[model samples]
Target: MSCSGMETVDELELVVERLMDAPVAAVWKAYTDHLNDWFCPPPWRAEVQVMELRAGGRALVTMYGPDGEVVPNDGVYLEVIPERKIVFTDAFQAGWKPAGPFMVGIFEFEPQGDKTLYRGRARHWTKDALEQHKTMGFEAGWGKVAEQWEAVAKRLA
Candidate 1:
C-alpha cells in the first residue's frame, strides 16, 4: 500500500508499531539503558556485553535461554537520533569491519501527545531468512520484548 506517494519497503519483516504509555525521552532511556533487561522474550535473558550508542559504535549482545543456550550478536550503530531513532545492522561490525549480514534493525520513537509511538522493523537479507524468522516466532518474541520495553519505559516515567 502506498500512502502520500510513498511506498513501503517489501523487504521489511517482523515490523511492529506500538503505542507506549510514556514520553519519548523515557522510552529512549529504557531502550538504551535497560536493554539487557527487556531485549529478550520470556524464559530468556539478554546480556549486553558492550554498547557504544553512537554511529559506528559497537553493540554486542548475547541472549541466553532457560536451557543455557547462548546466541551472540555483534553489530554497529548505523544511525542514532537522540530520543527519536536508532538503526543498527549486523552487516558491519565496529570500525567498519564487514561481517556476515543477518538483519538490520530500525527502531523509531515519536512523540504522540503524552505518549510515545514505538515502531520497530527487522530487515532480512533473504526471503528464506525472513520466512525462517517468522516461523521462529518473531511476532511472539518481539511482541513480548515490546511489552517489556513499555513496562520499563512506564516505570522510568
Candidate 2:
C-alpha cells in the first residue's frame, strides 16, 4: 500500500495519511463497522444510515452538528477490498444511476507489522471543487477525524 513517489495533482486531490498504532484488521473493523464513532470531528457526529461495503452499494451517512446542523452524504462504493482499500464516489447513486458528482474518496489501510498505515485521498472533478474542499477545512477536519479513528482503532486492539 506504499504510494511512494506518487506525484499528487494538487489541483485535484487532497490527502491525509497517518501511522496508526493498531493492526490493519482492527483499523479496518473500526472503519467499516464503527464509522459513526469517528467519522466526524468533535461536537459533530456521523450516523451511518446505509453502508453496503460491496461495489455499487450505497454509502449514506448523516452528519449532525452540536448546534443542530444536519448534513447528509449520499454516495456509492466504487470499490471495496476488505482490510485493504475502499473507494467511493458521489458520481452515481444506487443501481448505477448517474448523479451530480463531487469527489471520489479513497481510503487505504496498509498493514505494518502490528500497526497500520492509513491513507485517505479525496479527488475532486475540478480545481474549483478541490479549492472548495480546502476552504471547507479539509485538512484540519480530516486530520481530526484521523486522530479519532486511530483512538477508536487502538481501543479495538
Candidate 3:
C-alpha cells in the first residue's frame, strides 16, 4: 500500500473517488444506516445478512439480481474509524476464519468544507483478480452506489 497525501495507490488496487455535496456525518450515516437502500445499483438489491460495525465484526451480505438470482458475500470488518474509514476484507470471515482470497475494500470519508470526499479502494491479491474486477464493472457499479449514497445523504440533510 502506498499513500500520497490523502490519496492511496497500490499495485493491484481499483479505486473510485467522488466529492459529495454532503457532510461527513451524513455520508457515514448513509453507509452505516442506509446501506441496504443504496448499496446496490438500481435494478439490483442488497441484503445485509449480518453487519457488526466494530473491528473484527461480521459483514455478511447478499446481492440479488433483478430476476431473483442471489450472490453471497462473506466478509469481515477489519477496521472501523468512526466516520472516517472502514476497512473490510473477503479474505476472512467472522471469527477470523480464513477464506478464499478476494478483494479487500477500504472506504474513507474525508471532511471537505461542509461536504465530504468519498474514496473507495478495492485491493486484490493478484493483478489478474484486479483486472477481473475491472471487467466486472467495478467502477460503474461502485460509482452508482456512491451516487445513490449521496442522494440518501442529501435527503437526510
Q: Write the per-residue lDDT of candidate 3 for residues 57-147, one digit (tens) a residue.
A: 9998899999988988998999999999999999998888999977899999999988888889999999888888888888788888888
Candidate 3: count the clashes.
0
Residues 59-154, candidate 1, lDDT per residue (tens digit)?
999999999899989999999999999999999987889998878999988899878988788889888878887878777777778789988998
Tell me the tens digit of each residue's lDDT in model 2 across 1-157: 2222222557688888888888999999898889999999989999999999999899999999999999989889999999999999989878888888989999988899999988889999998888888889888888788888988999999
Against the unseen true structure, what C-alpha lDDT does each candidate score? 0.84, 0.88, 0.86
Range of the 10 consecutive residues with the lowest summed lDDT in candidate 2: 1-10
Candidate that would win on lDDT: 2
Q: Which of 2 and 3 is the better model by lDDT?
A: 2
- At residue 38, candidate 2 shows an lDDT of 98
Off by over 4 Å in 3: 1-8
The lDDT, on a scale of 0 to 1, for candidate 2 is 0.88
- TM-scores of all predicted structures: 0.91, 0.92, 0.92
Query: How many angstroms is residue 75 displaced in model 1 relative to the true structure, after the best TM-score fit?
Result: 0.6
